[model samples]
Target: MSTPKKPTEAKAKPGEGVSRRGFIRDVGLGTGAVGVALSPTAALCAPPALAGPGPVPVTLTVNGKQHKLELEPRVTLLDALRNYLDYTGAKRVCDRGTCGACTVLLDGKAVYACNILAIEAQGKNIQTVEGLALSPEPDPLIRAFVNNDGLQCGFCTPGFVMAAKAFLAENPNPTLDQIKRAFGGNLCRCGSYNGIRRAILEAAKSAQGGGKNA
Candidate 1:
């Protein structure tokens, strides 16, 4: 009888004969490459560093006083006044220029303090609501506002008073329509438009004579 032939052993294909250890090593190398590419320290993946100028000495003339401050050029006049100089009369409501809550007199013209830079206000006359009451008695505009009840919460009162002072200086005998047109930049959230108008009118009349028609 013929000897039984041994069963032929099966062999894996050439490319499929990888060892388990080799497969694991290849996978680990690929993962390491991916991590290195995505690393924040890598040149291509890094973000650019940003730098700005440091604070510099700034001289601000506010409320008839010269204040020497170390301020960055980007600092707003309102911030310099409220934060640095401690002139808190200009309310910081609506930091954007749209709200007149930060209004101040810049060289006798009404300007939004938040809109101007502290550096820009150098050598210019600056007047805040607090400056108005420097006298023994309150300013006539303040009296007029109180008499006419031109404020509610009073957050916006300082700005309104400053704007009115600037406006009345230019047009002491302004008509109601003119007053409305001039105060277009200012806003009163308390809906005190009527009282404000009347207050302005009263102040104008008081300026001319006692209770004289505008």
Candidate 2:
């Protein structure tokens, strides 16, 4: 009987199983694939000399002052105020639009500064908590807040002040229920709702007497 032949496995050499032409084509295709994958972020770290999105010139009028700022298009009005212009009266709580801590008056209407783009506020009059007390004496709204104890930590006070200021402007005289409804958008973590309502009511009284115009 002939000696049994041992089974041997065949090892593939470099490019042995594939045609040389196919191997070269696949390598080229792979390089192209890698280039495509990296193309999106290739320009991200490019030097400023390279053509890419750059800072944009934006003008924002705040508290009766015109401010020229160079900011990225993605910057929010809140960031421009607090970060750039040093207007920290609008507390930087709840960077999102939800908390109402960044409330401000845009053209006399209450808006969340965090939701508004700085560029979009061009030509519109903006009012912040700092504007509320421009004179030597504190405004009635501010006084009401102090007297009524509407603030605990005071983080949300500026927003409440601006919101109340806007609401009182539209409705100089509002009932307690109306005050509650008007401030529905604002949330006080300190649970000072009763004091806030009282402050608004007292401010309304002052407005009724024509003590100070908001």
Candidate 3:
């Protein structure tokens, strides 16, 4: 009969094998855990490093609520709203002052979203189209759009709505000529300006009667 090896010797190899595996696992997972823990904080505290000189922290009051965000110093209000805060109602088009597609409300005034840098809007009450639908949404303006068929592609509708709200707030009862002059800057390729104008008038009338007039 062949002689059997010692159990103590066998036990030593098994112990070594388990220790080796534990060492490998710890080494492999150590950096990954650290990376995960730090990434979310970096996102919350720092903006993406663009090819710019520096970044700025901005506080925006949107829809009667305050939000704190870190953004690149050069980022526009449109991009910051859509990309960072996930408010994408303001459409980005032309990106210059030519097209009014990215219109938003700043302190109850209409302003081009793409032109104003996000950091410049600090301490301002910035209202986006997203808020338009929040308080009993499909308000007078949205109802008018539906009734008048004011949207063709619907891309420029948000800008028009923002402009109209500002206009009506200024002149609750506006004539056709006044309405045309008020919304002159907004452009629509679908030729829906006529419908949009009528819709605004309807909404203004509705707003005059406490948002209940059909």
What does candidate 3's lDDT look like per residue over 86-121, in tens digits?
A: 677888877787678888999999999889987788
- Runs of candidate 3 with Cα error greater than 4 angstroms are 1-52, 210-214
Worst 10 residues of 3 by lDDT: 1-10
Full-model lDDT, candidate 3: 0.74
Residues 1-214 of candidate 2 have per-residue lDDT tens digits of 1121221111111122456786777667655655754676765665564421234667788889887766655567887787677788887676678889999999999999989877788899999999978889887899999999999999899999999999989988888888888887788999999999999989898868843323
lDDT of 1 by residue, 126-203 (tens): 999989899998888988999999999888899999999999998888888888888887899998988998998898
Angstrom error at residue 186, model 2: 0.6
lDDT of 2 at 206: 85
Local error of candidate 2 at 173, Å?
Answer: 0.6
Q: Comparing candidate 2 with candidate 3, which one achieves the higher TM-score?
A: 2
Candidate 2 local lDDT, residue 101: 90
lDDT of each: 0.77, 0.77, 0.74
